[model samples]
Target: MAPVFAHGQLRLYLLSLLNEGPRHGYEIMRDLEQRFNGLYTPSAGTVYPRLAKLEEEGLVSRSDDGRKATYTITAAGRDEVARRQLDLGDLQSDLDRSASQLAEEVRSRVKGEAADLRAELKAAAREARRVARPAGEPMSGRAGSEFERQINELRSSARKLVRSRRTSEAVRAEALRIVREAQQRIDDLS
Candidate 1:
């Protein structure tokens, strides 16, 4: 994947964020994460050092309220932001492109994984049917049909979830967990 921010771009971007309003370190991180649609989450190690650099440069001022420090942009910071308005716009465009690429990659991977799971489940179902049948007897009718229906429903649901742009990371993670557990149980059945 390409770097989300080019060299020195994040520093400027952080200043722009501060120019909007005063914020604590974690809030800045959260805001960045939200901006990227949960694609890029900056660690404290990444953000705090840059913040410290900005403070050292007198581009921002920090107020320590015992536990947490809130940072606000200085006059110089606003001047810098004003001076680099075009650059900031360009950076935002780059960020949007990067985020879109990342989202597409995630969607592709999820779709591929869902397809793999479907194939595995189908194979497992076949194995179970074969194992459950005697030499001359067919698979159990109603029970087998019901199991097939459940598998179809699972596949359909997984496909829909994977394809939905509105699906959140948390929801995607939980769905993956449930699918993996179901695959494990089905494997055990065979």
Candidate 2:
């Protein structure tokens, strides 16, 4: 994967953030994570050094309330932000594009995984049907149809869930739990 921020871009972006208002290190990291749509999370090693450098350059001033240090943009920081308005705009555009691409890739991967799961479930169901049936006897028509219908319903629901943009981690966890439970029940049959 490519670096999220180009050389010197993070420093400039951090300054731009401070230009908005005073912020602590954790808040800056959280803001970056949010701006990147959870695609990028900055470590303290990445952010704090840049902040210290900015303070050393007199671009930002810091105040400590004994617990944490809050950084406020200095006149120089605001001036720099004002001077690089065009760069900031470009950075914002780049971030938006990257986030969108990453999200699409995630969605595509999830769809593929869901399809794989469906295939595995179908195969397992077929094996189970074969094993449970007596030799020279066919499955009951109504029972087989109902079982296939339920499998199809599961596949359809999984596909829909994978495609939904608003699907949250909790929803995904519940879906996973259901899949696991179904797999466990299938194992119990064998």
Number of clashing pairs per prediction, in order: 0, 0
Tens-place lDDT per residue, model 1, 1-190, is 6678888889989999999999999999999999998888899999999999999999999999899999999999999999999999999998899899888877777676656655665665565555453445565677667656766776787768767886656557756776687667655754
Residue 169, candidate 1: C-alpha displacement in angstroms: 4.7
Top-lDDT structure, candidate number: 1
The candidate maximizing TM-score is 1
* Model 2: per-residue Cα lDDT over 1-190, one tens digit each: 4578878889999999999999999999999999988867899999999999999999999999798999999999999999999999998888788778777766676666556655765665665555464545665787667666766777787768756776655446656765786678776765
Off by over 4 Å in 2: 133-190
Q: Which TM-score value belongs to model 1? A: 0.72
Evaluate all candidate structures by whole-model CA lDDT and list the values in order.
0.81, 0.80
lDDT of 1 at 182: 60
